[model samples]
Target: MGKIIRWISWLSIDVVLGAVAGMLFFSKLFHVALPWQPYVLLGMAVWCIYNLDHLLDAQKVGEKLSGRRQFHHQARVPVLIVIGILGLLGLVGGFWWFGWGLELQWTFLLGGLIGGIRFLVLKFGKGWMKEFSIALFYVIGISWLPFLRSNSLDWSAWHGLFFLLYLLLANLNLLILSFLDQEEDQLAGFFSVSQELNTVSLILWIKYLMYGLLILLILVLVIIPSFYKLFVAILFLMTLCHWYVFNMDGVDSEKKRIGMEWAFFLPVLLIFLK
Candidate 1:
């Protein structure tokens, strides 16, 4: 069961699942319910890009199969080959389906650019910059729909507010994941913003930021009570995930990562909602 979970995680199926969830969130918020088929290509694109990131990082590891390095030992070559072909196909298919509109095109291109740029910054940037840069990359990657569709942000509507909320959640997700890997990152000589602060300070920062976002979300719910169920579902998941993070002694890091991934997988739960 553990190996199966590892395979699913390493193969980036969770990423595909997260992509669909993100797409659904966008569709629901924007009132633009695009067909589900496009997400397959988008998810594949994400898998490819992530694999490339994995491959690059693997180069820095020793012969040991520690951390994410173990994924390479399982199946490196075939995965990269598939990632290459599918990544290109996903890009082409996306352009063909979503059009070459200025906004959508910029979002697509900028997303890829950010993915690559992150590595360079991580390798060379100051420790203080790591968290903000990481947050920016995820926000751009997961919440690009607003930038893709709008001439300017429309915060008066729920869509814009939801987009910002996604960014905040994305930041929290990355921080929690990094917090789990602080030891591995330090041993590997990698730069993570969490490295700049003591564990308690970092955790406090994350907790305070999340509370602020949660308050804003609750306010949004008050404004649009029709979405009360959705926001409440989110609130529940956020609370659950935070519990796991705040009590890591009772739960292992791997389990915490899975719990957090479920947050990204939250939109999948909407199918069963009333």
Candidate 2:
């Protein structure tokens, strides 16, 4: 189980689920069938960038030569090679997906810029800035792909609502990951929101996030009847996540992260329902 989880993490398959979900949002809401290129672009960008983050972690873990650190260092060359290949693929896919269009190119560029900013902030900035940047970029990465091909720049109420809910979900996901990395972040002199908050305060914030999601679920219940099943599944999974955070998987950060990634798969329930 641990090996499987670790493989998924190392391969960054978790982020693929995110990319897929993002595409699904656009497809389901806008009735736009995004091509495979966008999915590949988003998935590979995430896979490349996430491993880069881990490589940085290995470096920052410092001098102790823990197993992870050793593995990261040893795998550095291969990871860099993979990133290069993925970047090349992204360039090709961008052309195929967007053509000579300016709007889509700009959107794609903006998403990359957001990812770059988050990378810089994670390296140098502290506290809520990094977390917010991460969540924002994540939303941009997946959402913009769908938006690029939209008939208009303006999103409808359904689009807006879905974006906000997904933003909160991404934010919550990053917070949990940040909480786990708080200690390492401290050692590396990086500030994280989790580092600043007391445990009780963090718990309160977590509760607020969970409640906010619940409220969204309730809204879906009353308002977005078509998405009622999808949101309900999200709510249930999120509640279980909140429970697992304090009581079950806090100690196993990798496993916790894996679980979070897998949660993205819940949206597939909509497919089955249909």
Cα lDDT listed for each candidate: 0.67, 0.69
Highest TM-score, which number?
2
Inter-residue clash pairs, candidate 1: none
Give a tens-digit lDDT track for model 2, residues 1-274.
7787677766677777766776665565555677666676778877887878778877776545434455667787898798889889877777776786985668767866876887788677767777778777777667775676676745567677677777787778777777766666666665689667866776678778877786766767576656445655554575466546535633676666677777776665555653
Error of 1 at 94 (Å): 2.5
Strongest candidate by lDDT:
2
TM-score against native, each model: 0.83, 0.84
Tens digits of lDDT, candidate 1, 1-274: 9887766776667766786677766655544545655667667867876677677666676546454566764567887888878977876777777787875667767867876777677777767566767656655565566345544443345555565677677777777777887777777776776668778887787788777766766676676757545855564476456655656677777767776776677776665662
Q: Which 10 consecutive residues of model 1 have the lowest summed lDDT? A: 146-155
Cα RMSD for candidate 2? 3.0
Error of 2 at 190 (Å): 2.8
Which ranges in model 2 have alpha carbons more than 4 Å from their true place? 63-70, 115-126, 152-155, 225-246, 249-251
RMSDs, each prediction?
Answer: 3.2, 3.0
Clashing residue pairs for model 2: 127-191
